[model samples]
Target: MNSLSAPQPVPLAQAHRLLNHGPTVLVSSAHGKRRNIMAASWSMPLDFDPPKVAVVLDKATLTRELVDASGEFVLAVPCRAIAEQTLAAGSLSGRDGDKFAALEFETFPASRVAAPLPAGCIAWLECRVIDEPQVQHTYDLFLGEVLAAWADPAEFSDGRWHFSAEGRRSIHYVAGGQFFSTGEAFEVSVTG
Candidate 1:
């Protein structure tokens, strides 16, 4: 799929909605000639309006090294269609070889970051790291300011998600190779 046409721009203020549901994300990073992709379930929106996000990256991972050197990364929300690849990404180490090619994944360049956004994802967030050395060193946490965000028009638009098709819905990772696809949507009124 063509990444440019597949994803429509999501306003900075509404970008957090893309990650608010807390699905597993593929964090992509590149510094100099080395580039890598990894699956991460410990990622979430930390703020809105000049949106910010936090994700846990182990200190020893190549992703951590790249993000530390480049100060940028792309968080792509993968759907059920790529579940196997997603699992493999997190399972293998980029130190072994190019994970993307090894997993037979495709990608396109991101607008605001050097890391390429993996194709077939439901949404993408290009971010620049917000330095916090203490927390970074102690907790292996990285915080970023969202520079750009995009979503698949078929699954998301107007700050909402419509997962009507099979294998097209966002997924949440459990342990091992298991995952749960986002289910039905509903609403309730609360009068304050």
Candidate 2:
């Protein structure tokens, strides 16, 4: 599959914009010869300046193992164009085989982490896992410090999303196979 557009760097201070609207993301990770990707809807930005994010990875998932071992992961925001593949990535188990090859997914190496950045995503966030074994084992929650961020120029630029093109918008998963495409744009002015 071809990328909708090339990814451009997003400032660390503005990295939260990519996830502010709450889109489902694919968490990709790798350690040595092991690599895996899984779709997650339970991810959110936890901080601003030193940008941090939190995501839930089930204990049984291969992604959890990879992230724990490597201390790194890449969060890729998949658009509507590759929604099916995104779901498939989450459903299959990497323990059986290489999910990327099995699902025909393509990826590129990230700059600051060993995790591979999945292709066809509108934005990518390379993260270094922040040690919090208590929450990790108890709640299946993992926190990461945003090391690098990138966005597809066509969908996001200047730290703002401009999804003017069809099938280029981000997606939010509901349940089962249902998902909602991010639609429309609006702004509210605050008067003091």
Candidate 3:
């Protein structure tokens, strides 16, 4: 709906924390005059230093094709607030038309990549693909170096999520169109 407020920049060292807990992400890519977004549940942080991330993109999907051509992408973590839209994105194919308008998603430019950042997502990671053609061909998995990262201030700051805003908590996907929001925070210590 509304564009994200001035998102706060997350330090490169802490960017891995964004996806550490496992949330479904909106994978956006742009090449030439076309851009597209798709929902993906199979993405994760692969490294800490230099901030690497791994995500699966289907060979048949336009988003994957775009990423292949552009060598860049943006993984925007959506929340319960836009669950319906996220599901719509996953269900729809991008070859027909503009998915952003079809899904009613608002987006803004990314500084280091052509991929636009979807609005309302709790966090955004702009990435450059690391050349890994063998794995990409065999498994459709992509490895990326996180170039820039951002988070919604009210929800995430100082490399941690403090979910105080409504419907802004990160979400996880279940099978058959079901999803779950992140639960309450808990902490534990060991002294043995």
Candidate 4:
């Protein structure tokens, strides 16, 4: 909802497409009076029909702890406009205080989850954690079944992404406070 537009619901079947291009996402979680957001680049779609996803959360992070407590989280695809905030979300420790207030990020409530969706993101995936204790304990990998999905229609709709401007573009983290905004898009046709 950055410069793109207000978010509209993306059909459940098309939710997986939001993260299909591997954009870095803002992972938001809340439990009781506490809430936090972290930037994660290691999330991906795991299923289609039920729309599931996978994300790795380090054991030491507070976001992980909150996720474990509440069993819900939101994965939001941030844009170039909020790249700095996204990096700050990943860099800081939420155990200190409320990162949402400390960083001054605006958010809206998610329909199907306790985690609030960051407003500047291009798309959002609200997920309920699927119970997979072995993988979660061993690898810090959490599996989630997407319960609801939303996107800025100007950026994504009809199961396609068409980023046409700098601020409108999604971001990918590289390292050292640097990020790559999504580039010009082109399509390739299949040939037999």
Candidate 4 scores a C-alpha RMSD against the true structure in Å of: 1.0
- Please give the range of 10 consecutive residues that has the lowest summed lDDT in model 2: 1-10
lDDT of 3 by residue, 1-192 (tens): 353467889999999999999999999999999999999999999999999999999999999999999999999999889999999999999998999989889998898999999998989999999999999999999999999999888888877888876588899999899999999988899999
Give the whole-model CA lDDT for all candidates, comma-separated. Answer: 0.92, 0.92, 0.93, 0.93
Question: Candidate 1, TM-score vs. the true structure?
Answer: 0.96
lDDT of 1 by residue, 1-192 (tens): 633247889999999999999999999999999999999999999998779999999999999999999999999999898999999999999999999899988988899899998998989999999999999999999999999999998888889998758788899998968999999899999999
Ranking by lDDT: 3, 4, 1, 2
Taking the tens digit of each residue's C-alpha lDDT, what string does model 4 give over 56-93? 99999999999999999999999998998999999999
With a 3 Å backbone cut-off (N, CA, C), the pairs that clash in candidate 2 are none
Return the lDDT, model 3, position 79.
89
Who is ahead in lDDT, 2 or 3?
Answer: 3
- In candidate 1, position 177 carries an lDDT of 88
**Model 4 misplacement above 4 A:** 1-3
Which regions in candidate 3 have their CA more than 4 angstroms from the true location? Answer: 1-4
Comparing 1 with 4 on TM-score, the higher-scoring candidate is 4
The count of residue-pair clashes in candidate 2 stands at 0
| TM-score of predicted structure 4 | 0.97
